[model samples]
Target: MTDRVLYLVVCGAPLAKRVGDGVRAARESGWSPYLIPTDAALPWLETQDLEGAPVLTANRKPGAPKRAPVADAVAVVPTTFNTLNAWANGNAGTYPLTTLCAALGARTPTVAVPFAKHDLAGHPAWLASLAVLRYAGVRVVNPHDGSSTALAPVASGTGEEVAKRFQWSWVLNQLQEAGA
Candidate 1:
């Protein structure tokens, strides 16, 4: 896995605050992880903590890391329902969306760990997006299917209570399973 780059795309979901943990987890799984947070997710990130690991966001200053490495694999953890629908519809409105689209276009293996609320999970758009991504060869991990830690409903409060619900390990496992 040396030299392999795993792009971790973080959407603006509640669990996005723990993206640094996900990056570390990805490294443990033998990948050099790059964190690309959607514009909506930027407020959750603490720049100092992500040293060495490249962080790509919507508003890059003159001296910031301007380019993301070419990805061999992509993991979209904290894939909120909105992002899922947007990405599925090929809406590259954000860098995170464009990066995911580029990876899919190149046939690079991609794994998505969605954090949709229990309510929205049943919506037609959500289901159809999942199906579309799957049909396009994206590996989608549903937390509610008894496969990993269950995400709390959207109303779940912040801090320790909700933190316990995100299945961070599942993203690492999926990326590894995709042969990243």
Candidate 2:
């Protein structure tokens, strides 16, 4: 895993606030994690600071980034419901989505840590999207239930319980298991 480049892409979700710790945890686990935040997730970095990781996003142009490392595997942490659905339906409309879609095309191993409200969780479309992503080889990690949907909030509160319950460990562990 040390030689592999692990990409940690963030979507807008409550758990995203504490992802810097997850970044450090990933480093401790021997993975080189690059942080990629979705356009909606961009504001997260303004209030949160993540050290020692190179952050990347698409330039909206049709070429590979000059400085971006090719992803050996990807973990879309705290993936929002909309992002999850769009990604499943082949919507590479955002920078994060475009990058992830490319990685999927190249057969790079990918994982997703989803976070959604209870109401959203019950939607048929959301469930189907989870299935689509899983069928496409993305290991959808369901922190709430062992079942598919693959979403779980750390705690009922905001992002405070992340250290105790966010399942950052699970994400990194799966990345390792993916040979990331």
For model 1, residues 51-143, the per-residue Cα lDDT tens digits are 478887764668876575688899886788888999999998878898888888888989887776667877889879887888888887754
Tell me the tens digit of each residue's lDDT in model 2 across 17-130: 777887788778877888889877778766665876878866645674466668788989878889888888889887788877887788798988777766777788888998
Best by TM-score: 2
lDDT score for residue 124 of model 1: 84
Which candidate should be chosen as best, given lDDT against the real structure?
2
Q: TM per model?
A: 0.81, 0.84
lDDT of 1: 0.75
For model 2 the local lDDT of residue 13 reads 72
Quality of model 2 by C-alpha lDDT: 0.76
Q: What is the lDDT, from 0 to 100, of the residue 24 in candidate 2?
A: 82
Give the lowest summed-lDDT range of ten residues in model 2.
145-154
Write down the lDDT of every candidate, Cα atoms only: 0.75, 0.76
